[model samples]
Target: MMSNPEKTDLKNLTLPMLERFLQGRGKERFRATQIFKWIYQHDAGSFGEMTNISKDLRTELAETARISKLEPEAVEQGSDGTRKYLFSLGDGNAVESVLIPIEGRNTVCISSQAGCAMGCEFCLTGTFKLVRNLTTAEIVNQIMAIRCDVRAAGEEIRNIVLMGMGEPLHNLDNVIPAIQIMIDGNGLQLSNRRVTVSTCGLVPEMERLGRELPNVNLAVSLNATTDELRDRIMPVNRKYPLKELLRACREFPLPGRRKVTFEYVMMGGINDSLEDAKRLLRLTSDIPGKINLIPFNEHEGCGFRAPTQAAIDAFHTFLIDRNVTVITRDSRGADISAACGQLKGNLENRKEII
Candidate 1:
């Protein structure tokens, strides 16, 4: 008989670790690679799918380990090919992840925390309040689930962005392991250049990440130019001011030809002025970086409005004229509340299931 879903806690173990455990039990070590491929490359959700393993071994696996624990509770698909997946964690708490399909690349946005502690005024997740940080297994499960979905659609994923739900740096313990698992060449095999970690300026963590994981791209959510404005919009700035935050960036090691991304969300009359653009250019001038100007995505209770198109264009031009590299991020999934700050899983009317 198949064991109860709760019988195994294998979600936390890497393929090599699982193999070691099986070897300790007198099983052949090679079974580990077969099972690992099944879980990651082939999207095997249960031990029953590992047909090559003996039924006794499968039974042992069923009793000893769980391949995945998260269950998608709801899915919201936007008209622009963006899909928001809301997953129910083991404790019944929920979080959201987004899959965006661009011209030639498919990017999955994975969350690190259930809700956010960084009280960014315009973020919906922040409004709901912090719940808890997600486990490393739960974080890896999100990617595996998305990869399964992509394979079913006859497509392949090309990139990953750690820009969903919560501040990654704040949950470094789990986030670091999750990132390593995602980049493991024998597993997900995604190149470090293709992975980006976005933070709300957690200085110490940022510095640590630079020294510890220098390969992954770094993105700082620098919404404002001044400490006064930043402190108002992002409460974390109170602990690590703009000066200190920039200093950390300056000291961060960057790979050749790879530049750190500075994410600036444009809210009308808030941080979208030409003057703000100039200040941004000055702040990032010393560091090799590119600016991703995001148009604010709105929700019902959120008071911010996206900057006018003309204003956004002018801001882009201001940066370009100053010889700063910039790109106005194309907004996707706005209609389904899957864009930038639109992911709030509190909606009582969603009908799609995982």
Candidate 2:
């Protein structure tokens, strides 16, 4: 459905917020739960599709509200079955989400903002810089829109990672509520373990995420082993240095069998040395988290090359031999530019040249 700025986007509201809206309209609070179930669980696109609700109420709701869904401006599929979607945000901006199907599980990597402000030296999105933070409806609609496609393909989105276009913690105001709806049993019904929020070391907001949504898995993008290196790569490190970031990580409350995940992108000739691995072991020894070494996904003009297989294997072996938990993540959708911000950047460049 088309966006209507004059009407309330019901997807923007959490359960309580929706309940209050209904109550203020002289309707029963239970109606909010019903509407939520229809919207989230049943995939109701229009208020009229919510047949269980009274026709009169549905008419009233439709006038004041709209159930907005993002229709992808374009979709690209990789040979490995990973699909990247470009969704227009209706204000001359767009964001992307990647759907990865691996070994019977589907994971959707969702964006929290239209473009990134993090300015990581290796990232493509950083070149474009920040456009704006996505609203709650925008974030939730990524899941809703993709889930429809997943269902059609006879699969389901089993996991979600906030590791796409933007830093999740930077937009916690909208991200947290979108997360709350995701884990809400009556809504998305995803277990807290299934939803992962990846941050580029936003320490203070990371602490708030732990305190507020302690059960959801947290993944920190700890790409560098030293502050000198990290400060050069991830700009956020300059503000919340390694010592303070690790302190907050150590304090983060993880639930049973859930350790924080440290995602280290191995950049060839950059942060992929055995020395860096040894330093990484020392850095993460105390924190209850495992290392996920991602060989950097190379892109045009980024100036950073993907780590050699030898470098990746060496890093994994060192961490494993030292009794540190670690795994090498397979780079998915490379043919489709599935790496964060690649597709969006390419589209924008094409438009410029056109």
Candidate 3:
């Protein structure tokens, strides 16, 4: 609300950094918890609404700090109850988040960058050039916005998937802090298991994530079994490749009883063959993980089509026969272009598909 005020964006600060910010302003460091609660828990958009804090302190905060907002451009609901929100950023660029609910749990898919640079041919997000990495506030704001939306609809979110738009590891500097806030006991209190970060096998970054945030679940987009196949579709594969990528997953310190999730998008005649499934099983044999078969979400110009139902079934059956834990994940929000690998915002420079 402060116009051109020299205040810091409070949402950008981690709890400890916020503690320092409050202390620097001559406020008690513990006050950061209260402010965090107001922003993340109470969903307060402005300092004045934190009525529990002293009015004088509220005025102080109003003058010295601000919470940035993402302008809502559109909200589309899939007939299956999934919702997609398009949020406009300050620079006129936009990003999207998808809210998916299943049975007792509500899962929100959040973006880490405006577009994507991973260049996975099957992903629609890959077509748009990577404009910029989302700041910590921009990343966290998407969750907060979705949180408010879900609560208003009388549902509580139980899971969060960093599976939208860009590669999360590419924006680790901002994404990790946002994840810390999501899993902070004093804040969103999301169980580490409930929050998953999906990546296209950013080997070193994945290792770094293991060291820094070991508790959160990880899902790798292992869409192809062979490096040659992967290289053509996922450029990151050229750098990390399958061997090194799976090695990181194997070495990752997953909490007891937790296994990494291998997300394999089923692209027809590309990587959905029954033999591919067998190879996939062998590829993941050494790693403790489950296979999530995502039938490709099709869009124009992507040049890839979804695997046929029989192909998908045969792959699923092969994995089942091999005694691998496999799940054919239901693709939600395709009706709204909000399914995995299908999110592309309506920025002026980006082509609006759908």
After superposition, which runs of candidate 1 have C-alpha atoms over 4 Å from their true positions? 1-8, 19-31, 52-56, 347-354
TM-score of every model?
0.91, 0.96, 0.95
Best first by TM-score, ranked: 2, 3, 1
Query: Residue pairs in steric clash, candidate 2?
Result: none
Q: Please, what is the whole-model Cα lDDT of each candidate in the order they appear?
A: 0.84, 0.87, 0.88
Locate the minimum summed-lDDT window of 10 residues in model 3. 345-354
Better of 1 and 2 by TM-score: 2
For the record, the alpha-carbon RMSD of candidate 2 to the native fold, in angstroms, is: 1.8
TM-score of 2: 0.96
Model 2, stretches more than 4 Å misplaced? 340-347, 350-354
Tens digits of per-residue lDDT, candidate 2, 1-354, equal 346789999999999999999999999999999999999999898998998899999999999999889987778888999988888777778788899998879999999987788888888877778888999999999998999899998978899998888889989999999999999877898888999998888888999999999999999889998999999998999999999999988998999878989999999999999999989988889888999888888887888888889889988999999998898988788888886446453337534211
Put down candidate 3 lDDT per residue, 234-259, tens digits, no spaces: 99999999999989999998999899
**TM match of model 1 to true structure:** 0.91
Q: RMSD for each model, in Å, please?
A: 2.7, 1.8, 1.9
